[model samples]
Target chain A: MSELIKNFTRELPDWKPRVRPVNLDEATEAQLDALKVTPSNTKVSDYVLTLAHDVESLKIRSPLFNAIMYDKGGLKRSERELGAIGASVLNRCIYCNAVHMNRHAQLEKDTSVTDSILADGENAKLSSRDQAIFNFSLKLSSCPPKVGKEDLIGLEEAGLNIEEILDLILSTALFGWANRLMHILGDPVKLENNDS
Target chain B: MDALDTTTLRAAGLKGSLSAAAALQQRANILHLTQKAEAAVLRPKDFGAYNHELRHALAGRICNLNGDQITADQYSGNAGTYADLIDPGNDGGNYDLEQLVNFIDKVATRPSDVTEEDIKTLQKAGVQDPDIVRLSELNSFMAYQIRLIAGLRLFKEYES
Candidate 1:
C-alpha cells in the first residue's frame, strides 16, 4: 500500500521486456550470483530479473549498477538519486523517475525535495547546488553531445567538490544506462491493481 | 600505460582511467564482444563465409544511424552509407538486420515504440531466441556507452 509501490504498479506498459523474462527459479549460476550481490542483496526487482535472460551480461551489469549507486568514493546517496531523477526525466522514463524520486525521499527523510524534482526537474524549487546538479544530469541525459564547460562551472560554483562533481557525473551516466535498460527490459506491475 | 590518448579520452568526455577502471573496462570489453556476437550472427557457426565485413558493416551503420558517434568514431569509421548500408536491393537492407537495428534505435531514443513484434521479426528471420536476448542487451549497452561518453565529453572541459 506504500505510495511508491502503488504508483509503480499503477503504471502500465504496452510492451513486456524481451519476448519472455528470464524465470528466476530456472536461472543459472551466474544469474543467481548477480542477483545475490546487488545492493538490495535480494531478488526483489522484477525489472532486474527480466534482464537475467542474458545472464552473462547481467553478471557484470549488476555489480556495476551497485558500484555506482552505492558508495564507491564520492557523492551522498541522495544526491546520486538526484542525478538518476535527472536522467530519467530527460529520457522521459516515468518508471525510473518515480523509483528514484521515491528513493531520494526515503534517503533524505524529506518528501518535499523529491516532490519538487518529480514535479519540475531542473526547474524544481531547490537550492542552487541541487539545481546545478539536476541541470547537469538533465543535459547529460538529453543532449550529452552538447554538455558544456559552464555547466561544470555551475556545479563548482554551487560548492560541489571535485569528488562530488565526478560522482554526479558517474551516477548520471549510470542512470542513462539504467533507465534505458529498465524501460526496455520490463514494465512495472502491481498485484492489487492487476486488472486496472 | 596510456591505452587511449588524452584527446580521445577527453573528446569522449571520459578519463584515461576509463581503461583503468574495472567497471568501465569491463563494459569496453563487453562492447568488443558485440562485434563477435554479430560476427557469429552474420556467418554460419564454422563454415566458409560470404561476408566477413557485412555484419560488422551493418552494426557499424546502426551506430551511426543511432547517433552513437562515440562507438562509430572509435571502432568503425562512418563509412557505411545509408544506401549501401541498407542495401536497397537486399530486402530493404536485409529485413532481419534492418529490423534489429531499427529496434535498437527505438530502444535508445524511445522505448515505448518497441513491441514484441520487433523481437518476433528477428525470430522469424532465423535469429535464435538466445541470440535475440544478447542482441537486445547489446543494444542497450551501446546506448549507455554513447550517453556516458557524450556526458563525459560535455563535462571534460570543466573537470580540470
Candidate 2:
C-alpha cells in the first residue's frame, strides 16, 4: 500500500511532486541538455523532472552537489551524509533524511548509528566524535545559523581539521538548499511499484 | 574572478584570513560552482516571472529574514525598483506580491513548518508551476548561502 511516510526511516521512499513536472516531449533545448546529466540519462526521476522547471539552477546544482558530497580528501563520505541528515532532520525533509540515512549506513557498514538517530533524534546518543559533527551541523542548519566559536572549538577538540570542517559546513548547507526544495515542493511516499 | 572575490568568501569575511587561505584554496571548485549557482538563480536567461532586479530584492529579503544584514546589503545594490521588499517588514504588498513574499520568507526561515497548502496558495495567486520552482530555487539558495557565511565566520573567529 502506498502512503505518505511521516516519520524518519532508513527505508527509501518515493517522492511525488506537487507541481507539474516538465513534459519531456516539450522540454526546451536547455532543459534537455540539463536533464542529460542526471544520474542516469536513460531514465529521469520525477524530482529531476520537477527541478527541470528551472533548468539553469538544476544544471549548476548537479555538479556542485556531487563535488561537495563526493569530493575526496576532506570529510569522509559517511560523515558528509551525517551532515546531510542533520540538515534534513532540521528541515523535516523526510525524503532527504531517508536517502542520506541509508547512505550513511551503507558507508559505515553499520546501522546502529542511524538507528540511534531515528530513535532518539536530537537526543540521539553518539560517540564524542559523532556528537561533535552532528551537533555542529544541527546548529549550522538552524534558522539564522547558531554556530559559534565553541562549536568550532568542539570540532577541533573532536579532531576535525579545518579542511574537514569546511567540508562538513558545505554538505550541511547544501542540504539546507536541498530540503527546502524537496520538502516544500513534494511529499515523500512509499509506493508499491514506483522505482524512484 | 579571484577566489577571494567570491560572494561567499567576501560575505563571510574570509578573504584575508591567513588560516583559512589554504582550506579555501582546496575547495576552490565548490566556491566557483557556488558563484555560478548564484547567477543561475538570480539572473537566469529564461526567467519566467521573476526578473533580475526582483530576484535580487527577494534574495536580500531572505538574507534579512535570516539575520544577515551584510549579505542583504550586498544584494540591495542590485535590487533596484523592488529594493523596498528587501525589508522583511514590507510584506511585498506594494507590488501585489504579498503572497509571494510571505511564501519566500516562510520557505527561507521555516521550511520545516511549510505544508502543501503553501504551494497551493502561490498557485491560487496565479503563480505558474515553473515560476514556483524558480521562487523555491531562489529561496533555497539563500538558505544555503546564509548558513555558509555564518559557518565560515565562526571558523574565522576560531582562527583569529
Question: Each prediction's TM-score against the native?
Answer: 0.70, 0.97
lDDT of 2 by residue, A1-196 (tens): 3598899999989999989999988888888899994446647899999999999999999999999999889999999999999999888999999999999999999998899999988778889989999998899999889999999999999999999999999999999999999999999999567486
Error of 1 at A136 (Å): 1.5
Off by over 4 Å in 1: A1-18, A24-45, A121-123, A191-196, B1-70, B77-92, B112-132
TM-score of 2: 0.97
- All models: lDDT? 0.58, 0.92
Model 1 clash pairs are B13-B152, B13-B153, B86-B93
lDDT of 1 at B57: 46
- Give per-residue CA lDDT, model 2, range B1-160, as digits (tens): 7855789988998887988788888999999999999999999998999899999999999998889999998899999999999999998878999999999989988899999999999999999999999999999999999998999998678877
Q: Give the per-residue lDDT digits (tens) of candidate 1, residues A53-76.
A: 566566567555676678555688
Q: What is the lDDT of residue B159 in candidate 1?
A: 41
Cα error, residue A63 of model 1, in Å, equals: 1.3
